[model samples]
Target: MASQNILDVVVVGYGPVGQTLSILLGQRGYQVAVYDRWPSLYPLPRAVFHDHEIRRVFHAMGIGQDVESISQPSATYQWFNADWKTLVEIDWSSESISDGPVGYLFNQPSLEALLDRKAKSLPCVAVHQGWEAIELHERADHCELKLERVTMQDGKVTRSGETQTVKAKYVIGADGANSFVRKSCGMAFEDLGFQEDWLVIDLKPHEGVKLDVPDIGQWCNPERPTTMVPGGPGYRRWEFMRLPHETREDMQRPEKVWELLSPWVDPEQATLVRYALYTFRSLIADNWRKGRVLIAGDAAHQMPPFMGQGMCSGLRDAWNLAWRFDLVLRDVAPPALLDGYTPERRPQVRAVIDASIAMGQVVCTSDPLKAAERDAAYLAGDVPPLPPFPGLTDGLIVRTQNSADGGIAGQLSVHGQVQNHGRTMRYDEAVPTGFQVIGLDVDPQACLSDAALAALDQLGAYTIGVTHDASKVVANRVLYDVSGKYQQFFAQHDAKIVIVRPDYYVFGAARSAAEANDLVGMLIAEIGLDQASAASKSHASAVA
Candidate 1:
């Protein structure tokens, strides 16, 4: 065997995405190095969206369970008039998305700290906080990252100098909207720049207003439209609409900011913390994986915050790649196995962007005629619930062996209760551990010949072959199912080998053992693993 690479992954930037990636890689025993321009996690809170999947990622990192107590549950989603009259209401508590908690009410700082701590806890992860990736170049086999050293003073730059280069086999860019890595990779950000500017202010109400309202509440009118969200830990967020020709001075008038909130809460009780102007756009990269480097999160796609999936989409990308990297890094899968990451993610990435734009059009409607029409239509007493977000394709994608059903059909069934006393194994329940799931509608012994069973016992994959109701099979892999209904995969993507990546996204499926063997062989080939190891009796004996 030739010498293997010393480092497996080099992650750029130390934001949530970067930190999460580092910790995941480290946990998998990969030598991971991280570079970031900033040394400290700012108490600054910038984003607002956190869906159920994001919470699951946090839980996977051992950090999510605390989000709800700090951030109140948004129970009733609504649109209100500037005069404070309700226009439209949707039940946010509908438990619409999944059994997993959806729509976080917390801010960025808290979440980042949680992730930052997790990254530092990993034994194989090294974080270089104050270093920035100043330059980058990829050779035929290796990619090089040049980190520049810098010194800063009271809110200003003091000194900038020498660059240190680090080489890695795989690189991930979670930098930011203005990602240097993305820019250097020659990936273009197609910003559909918004026609209006939005002024967002973070405030801590002196006397907090405790109300169960929305995942987000939109105050819509032609003149001014604002959004209010619960920013956990006594923090409240406000996004005020900015019209053309309006100056920051006009928006800063304490009276103007208060008018938007005074309807729901007292003016004297709230104090503004931070305020900034924003223009929304939905953008996607033409290509996600370019050469040796790949991009995720804001670095790859930028969606308006209207739909609250901005961060969730990115975290899902990290989830999908992290486990696959484990396979490739450990030489378990073929290197080209990484090829599927981009194609699998790009469709959903683009879908979220489109979802945001479509939803934004409805939530932020400003046309006088249209606004009146919306109000009149609501008064007419016939408005369907918020149009289902097509961005959620988790349930729709079915990959199973049951070809007619579009899901993998299982042949594993035993007429009599045949017990494998020697095996002494059953699916572990209670604690949630994410794994690649193989659901058996019946008994496993009936599904395979000795050879196939022997092969599975060899790979040692974290695959739970559960023999029970199809519903019970999906219950353990609950984190990945957006709707907590994984059994639907039977009808969505027809196949028996339902390959689910860590992030809950299906990689692809195989309907038969031959297909599974082919997919497994392809994976093994990529990681430089013994090709026959995935399907051979010899591989099985080694594990045994």
Candidate 2:
């Protein structure tokens, strides 16, 4: 017999990604349970930096200010050479992010602790601590989760000796690299292990050694490109290239570690706080979704630490997937709608993987000549250290033009408007309910009796008539350049109404009143947000 209990989502693995997912889903009114095997978090410095996008999500969750207060902001990046020579130093503090929070650094544990608290504070969220998931049950309409609860001390053990089953509409796996869910789902992970081991050391450099690091540091040491990044005051991190056949067993001795650090350390004054061995693999699950069971974070993709994107990638996964479930829970969409996840996210994850591998090859090079070539590329602006993609770059949503380029009303299209100004631009209001259309050349009388116009206004779409000004003209969309205010900006775009989605994706150019009506219908169906519309209602019946 199936359990009659109800849950919107059961997030497997309550690490950073899972926890963040739970909070977002819970806030959206979904009954979410965040599961993890550990009773509490481990205190250690693992990953240390987060890009501006992470900070933005935290802020959206209402903890952005608190996270900023606790985090050490590093807006500067520096790369070095074999002789500890400086190559490129880019100040990140002044970066322009398209959306979400900017760059910040916190030790892994501290960040986890904060997320743990946030998860607990969520209204409809449950933190299933000490619960180990042993099996998954995905049915046509729901999923059943089987878990084991455990408790143990330094020398004793006490446990429930029982299994708990949770019935949820959907599930997500956020476990680490060796993810049980990924394996259980029968998903294939393309594991390409070129270099597998690392000798990592975590410590704080003395005053004379610490650079006013914006939060990250990359070393181009040819013999061993050892990267040293500050975690917090009196805390830093070092990742050394593992020498041939040098096992962790051989490096257990403090003296042996001292010898490793001697080249860069002043033999008389340096001390090692924590040192251990690590391994890395470039693995991406062939797919992120399988039935009702899904995976995110390291469970989804694993790459080298060259780009500091591992955790950030998983967090983005949680952000993207959680919202889909929210739509399902509200009964506005069918569960199968989640199928779109893999196509949208896999490409971005692969891009991150390729970028990580390419970056690792560049920074971890032992050849002095090749190292110089890499540095020259950076200096000459031949390449970005890490290429920007959708999730990491504020989840970009580019516009799509209709036939003849502009909206049905081809005369008012802003087709080629590109924002090149140094200003960080943003729409004054959040997404409206339905569709938004920006019309630079508008008939003020058009607002009356325009069903599309009324719907756009009700939904908070940006259906505005424009007469551009010389000020702030770059990023803002300009149409029907009557005043010649955005002369340069308009030079690229034609006159037409530009339609922006609630998700900030451009749905289409509103070519005509008739096209505008059809475009709104298209978005309503695309997002599965149409609750009472007859067209969407009829589509639902046809699918059924």
Candidate 3:
């Protein structure tokens, strides 16, 4: 009887990742219930940075206006040695293909609050705070989750707990590092061989006052490795590595914290908002999915803070999984489509972890001799190159001659300033959901075959043609690329048409109408749409 009311999806955890997933599911008209132990959002600073790709996700969720209000563009991230000499610098201020600042710094609490408000406005989304998912039972058609209602006395002190059960077609674990869902699934982690404890402090000065500190930089001094970064609008953050002899309790003391901040500001002048010790670890889950149960965010992987991608990566996972789940639940495609999620996302997460660990190695040095050597190498103009942004290497991406190498396939689709009808906005804002067929000064509809067109229509894909001149309108949803980025991208890839997935990844591309049809056919087959169509045909024949 309980199984009769099974939801479309059950999400365990109400953090940013889980909340984002809930809203996405709600937007798709899926019944989603989110469970978390805490009664409210964590009102402290956690993640402080996100890149353009994440900003794109925010826009998809209809909260772009809110994000612009609370976020500030991040500057170059510089690294310096003992003598304050510059080593390697990553230019985060450059424009990303997503049509915004490469990176932005913002308060995590504010972002989460905005997400919570948006989630509440949706009818299909229900957040059950003070409830925790404690146990799991997998059935043939649905997953069962046992949830506990937690009662707290003094804001956080747990007083009592009551348990209940809910069934869902699928279960997603977006909980933090210490996830009960991951443990319930008996999943293990593959340690990437990196761990360190560091004391993190957040401070805010009196109104109309500003603390004097570098915007963002790493101090690679052998005596003490430290990091200073802008913590949103009126806040600042500093992280100090805990030496071998230091304990977590000692480093968290107010006096010890003051000693670390003495160089920048007087402890008496500024208010210490939050201070805590964190152990940064590098790990990736051995398996992201087991049967109908899947894990995302920290439950799937964890990385050091060097790249500021810890939370951003989790958000990406949510975005990637949301569309796949939506497609399966709607029966638009077969359940096998979900198989691509782990393969497509794990490699991307691994790339982020590896890059973060490499950056950590550069800043976690404790030897005087090695520090001197590093500084000397930098002084001699021998700085190492920063790693390029990671892209998808496998699963649901094209790797053929019709949509040849160096094409847009498997990469994130680029955004440009576009004018649609009389309105001007980013390209993505014009086409927010589903697969899109974009053509450069060409009509994609005319290029696709009847079968391909039928499949795309079934998927609810948007067909738009981008042209440089507004006078030459050749398609219904033609947008004028005012910034010229779109034209540049098409020319560089030698493609007239490109297929973009719902999550804004390039599915494939082609230089001509026939090739465009082939590209669309390839995506249809790869995503199991062809199988669904075949099954429908066989069922009709059997009925006859």
Candidate 4:
């Protein structure tokens, strides 16, 4: 039976992406229903890495500590040649703009379990694990999804002969590469033409047994390119690229598996957890939204695993959509606000896919001659460094005519510790999560007009003042910058005030308080809040 009331959102898929989106929406008090065909969480490893930005997302979900407990911070990701010469080293152990290690490695299933528990604990979230979304219909204001109950029998999904229909104001497809919602909306992928197969194996070391390996790195040996990295807290993972001469069946044989692990550990030293072949690809949906239906995660983009951003990108999608959907559902922003999703996310996703493909190209080379050329280039410093991870490049952000890179807008806002009300905590914890107007050594409230103040209030924005002076710390409006990160950021950008969006991206930075007010005005204009407010009043009058 279908619920008589419409849900605020219905998520199709129960993987980490869907779980993350549901948790974010549910945290904002939305009625969310999640459907997954699988009878239970897939009890194996898949994605094994997440970066600092994703750590912030986990923090927002109130599971930061739990996730940290199950993961290990990564070290430098060193790539080596066939002769064991260092080709390139990417530092992942250093502190990031998000104020933590640049990356962390974890078992995907364990992370999913944590997210699942957090999502289901929310009062407004209903998780239907054994139901599969078979059909979807998007209408003027809502979407209808038909779900069939299924069971896992003999490791396969089988129909259970029960079905139901549910309605929601919006639907999200966090389903993987073969996404039903994306296909239902008649969307297509813009393939980036990168694909390769590899055999991934996970092993749990026997108690008190130790094996020396790279903390996290890739062996770009032309004979058999390999990846060795941490698999959560106590396990380890290794992926070997399938060579042209090796058949998939031959590679999966027990003897072959043993031969591959012989270089690292023997069977007696470690227990094989799981092993499978994966065809990594690079793809991005041409269009991410249709009517009230949208796609995220693997449904929207997929990339090779060389950069370990496959799961991070999806969680980012969830974070981006959560705030936008919150505003639309609350009528704080016009429905057109949803249009910004694709423009803002797709470019960033494409950048990652491109970067991942570039890295994969370097690691997946199997030709000895080409590998030698690549080694020489790296050894001689001819290889170009991977481009820095991209930020939002379009949509709903303030852009100046003279600034080509949006003048610090669309970049991640800096996070640091602050002292508020005689207690110290991370800056995000000091202020409520929403649009933030943070003044460095200035008072944001003193610079805004009454209209601007009213607009910010309507949008639930947090206007805060941060300064090095301890005497200036006020209960809710001002905080003491204990870590000096805010001061350094302001000095670096030469800005006095920074306007951060709900998703933690800087909307814009301003040189003065008046300019900060203008940034707020720009945000209000971009969101079309005035028109939305007018429409609400008109509807109320008609009802009266």
The model with the greatest TM-score is 4
Q: Root-mean-square deviation of each candidate, in angstroms?
A: 6.5, 7.4, 4.0, 3.8
Per-residue lDDT of candidate 2, residues 1-544 (tens digit) = 2346878888888778888898888777788887887777756677777876666567556676677666786656777766556666756665343333345667777788888888898889988778777888688888888887877465243567677888987888898887878888898988766465677887656666733432466777777667767665456666777655567677666777777666556445545567777776798888888988899999988989877788888887876676567656766566666776786667767878887787677677877788778767766778754544433111122224432233222121122222223332222222222235555444322432344434333333454344444353322333233324323322345434455433323445444444445665555556554425432221110000
Runs in model 1 lying further than 4 Å from the true structure: 1-6, 66-71, 81-88, 96-98, 151-158, 193-195, 207-215, 252-267, 377-435, 440-446, 449-460, 463-499, 506-531, 537-544
Q: What is the total number of backbone clashes in candidate 4?
A: 0
TM-score of each: 0.79, 0.76, 0.95, 0.96
**Highest lDDT scorer:** 4
For model 1, what is the C-alpha lDDT against the true structure? 0.62
In terms of TM-score, which candidate is stronger, 2 or 4? 4
| Candidate 4 lDDT over residue span 95-154, tens digit each | 888887899989888899999899889999999998989989887878989999999876
Sort by TM-score, top down from the best: 4, 3, 1, 2
TM-score result, candidate 2: 0.76
**Runs in model 2 lying further than 4 Å from the true structure:** 1-4, 87-91, 99-102, 152-160, 204-215, 232-234, 262-273, 367-518, 528-544
* lDDT to native, each model: 0.62, 0.63, 0.84, 0.87
| Per-residue accuracy of model 1 over 1-544 as CA lDDT, tens digit each | 1124546889987887888888888877888999877767755777756765566566666665665545555566677765557877766555522343345567788778777878888889989877778778898777888787766454454446766788898889999888988999999777655445787878776754564444468877777777887777678787877776688677767777666566666556667787767767777887778877999888988887877777777887787788768766666555665776776667667766776776577667777889788777766777765544332233223333332233222111111111122232211223234334343342222344444444444444444333324243333232122232333544344545554434544434556544554554443343345534544654221111
